[model samples]
Target: MQLHDSMIKEIEKSKDKIIENRRLIHQYPEVGWTEIKTAALVARELESLGFKVSKGDVVISSKARMGVPNQYILDQHYAETLALGYSEAELQPFKDGFTGVVGEMKFGEGPTIALRFDMDAIGLEESLSTGRGPVDKGFVSQIKGQMHGCGHDGHTAIGLGVAESIAKVRHQLNKGSIKLIFQPAEEGVRGAKSMVEAGVLQGVDYVLACHIMANEPFGKLICGANGFMATAKMDVRFKGKAAHAGATPNEGNHAILAACSAVLNLHAIPRHSAGETRINVGTIVAGTDRNVIPDEARLKIETRGANTAINAYVKDYAYQVIKHAGLMHQVETEIEVVGEAVGGKSDEQLIDIIGSVAKRLNVFDEIVASDDHAGGSEDFTYMMSAVQAQGGKAAFFMVGASPDGTGGIGHHTSNFDFKEDALVESIKLFTGIVLSLL
Candidate 1:
């Protein structure tokens, strides 16, 4: 699909503005459902540009929300962004404290197309060392402990840029609808399904979403990285009695001990011979003082499998381990599923469309015509699966951009970041595909 020369010029004009928007978002990184400032900015911009926009819980199913922060936390974040400049009216839709945006426009009657961009940051303390951190670049996140280590800020900016390019040519667009989905809580794989539950995929015909530099170099692009792994995120809590350690150690039941046991047993689970699988206890909290036995312990554990059956196998084993660990320590335990996603595959037909479009753009160092699915998981799978369930075609791509030449740093860590230039390529690539489809 060749983007008309005029259409190419339209996208070319938005390049600088796109990079600027990316930096603005990078400076204020918000995590998951707490994206008040981000969502508001997205909604306001799309609304001003003349698209019908939907915001907040209306885009999510409350009953399906999982692992949400407590109300106090949600309210605190909401207040913070409100103070940053968003008005109460702009925030009214977020009354019950959820955040996301969907901007849709039907330009004459073609197939309905959706672009998904995640709007969330990770819980990692960004680097501050001289010349080695985002802070040194002046666009550092103002919030102390949060960071946009994942290139999502770039993703959001690109989505907005793509929308603008598409809008400029609306007069020529015929026979199709376009939807821009600025999603939240993607870090934990928790937002997409709710939107799916909210009927966001109804009548949709094509879907495409991308993630930045999983390892590919700054100029390389993976037309389709097969698909990501199936995954399940769980929160476990163990309850026990607390007592002074020196006075009577036996009188106290240690919940931390139970958590430790579970963490070890979780890692000890046999690997799946069928395919790649992974289990990790990412965070653990328990105990106040070293002299006292902790009464409560909590764990943020996750499991991943290359496919549905393998993921199910690992999830079942993980649960058994959690249950038995509690029994071994004689403590009551509770478990809650925070999020889940089944493994997925890109539609080959759609992949070819994207590859052809990307080639004509004359950008990207390498275009991976095809590749194997990932060992990690992504909630975008939920949206893609939903679209496919209704006979629609879907594709997920990898936008490679690495500054140090090591493929952007580790995704969920403190040093993670990709070249902002990826945003430019993304805006061009995504818009090109939309033009071809429309």
Candidate 2:
């Protein structure tokens, strides 16, 4: 069945409201897991739409804070972490605020369909350039050093618009249930797994999510992409005796040398010809003094590929590199797997559904069916895995939000931004998906 013209027209009428929400969210950007303010706004909006909203753990509530050593002292020590370069400070807040909201609209008895929207922003500052026009004329993030450079502002607004529009068609959706999930902490790739564990898809029969594409031009929507890369984030540490470098060099096992060797070998991991693979050592810290032998060294590494096998292969190789590097340097080592995401493939059946709906709505030209291997990973992989395990089909679509001919900046970049019109189209596309499924 085609999306009713009346429904499309109604969505068109709400475009202004959608833009307003986008701007409001953009102004008060919140980072992953620390989305308390964003959550409050989302919950309030959902409640206003007459949907039953549950807060604090039922759907989206703060997780218990980690019992780190000297919690109170650590909190005071990292008070300035909201600053751009002080990301480690932001981590604790994210851990504490990492929660999600699930809004459900019931229709007649039918298969349950779920729609997810990530609500967390990245830690990059928005560009203040006047080139993108007036929408960004005075758009500066109120929170210092935090901004929605990743277009999640647009995504959250689109989700709300879809939620509202779908509610308007609740009478016609009597055949099935549509669930709206506002997930938090996507930037660090940590939120979706928790939501999945909380049974967000307990009765879910199908799932769909959309992300704004920065490189694509406005007015276009990408229905199917090859898939996202499977990725793992790891922390590696080396321990050694600390001794004065000038007076007792032989007394310390040099942890810095071990860590450096591991970093170099990590890049030597072979890539598979079957799909893309990547390894990067993003951070390294060691040593307390220049005149002393380093007592400890730490490294943050990430591995990714288009599929699970390659991803696993690289991760295993990474572990070996760290182990041998420590052995070679005579420094004890520890490796911790901090985060992971399985690669995802869009189902052809669902891709076709999105394409057809876009066509009927006269937005088909904006939809492209192509495969992309993004090295970046998403926790949404967990949701996809959970749903697929239950024999449910899933698709993650990409919506273009970049102005024509301007790639803007890549995600996580300080200059990352997008066009507003794409928000309206995304809402309509998602709303149409709910209607079709019902």
Q: What are the per-model C-alpha RMSD values against the true structure?
A: 2.2, 4.7
- Per-residue lDDT tens digits of candidate 1, residues 221-281? 8888674899999999999999989999899888999999999999999998989999999
C-alpha lDDT of all candidate models, in order: 0.86, 0.76
Task: Report the C-alpha lDDT of model 2 over 1-438, residue by residue, as the tens digit.
Answer: 446888888989999889888888888787665665666677778878878765446654334211122445334423534453434432433334544677777766889998889887776656676665323466667776788877888888998998888778776545878788888767656667767777788778889898888887766677866568888888889998898899889988999999999998899887788988999999999999889899899998889877888999999999999999999988999987666778887788888988888887786455686457655777777788789889998888887777654655477766677778788788778877777776
Candidate 1 RMSD to the correct structure: 2.2
Q: What is the TM-score (0 to 1) of candidate 1?
A: 0.93
- Candidate 2 contains a number of clashing pairs equal to 8
Worst 10 residues of 1 by lDDT: 128-137
Winning candidate number (TM-score): 1
Query: In candidate 1, how many Å is residue 270 off?
Result: 2.5
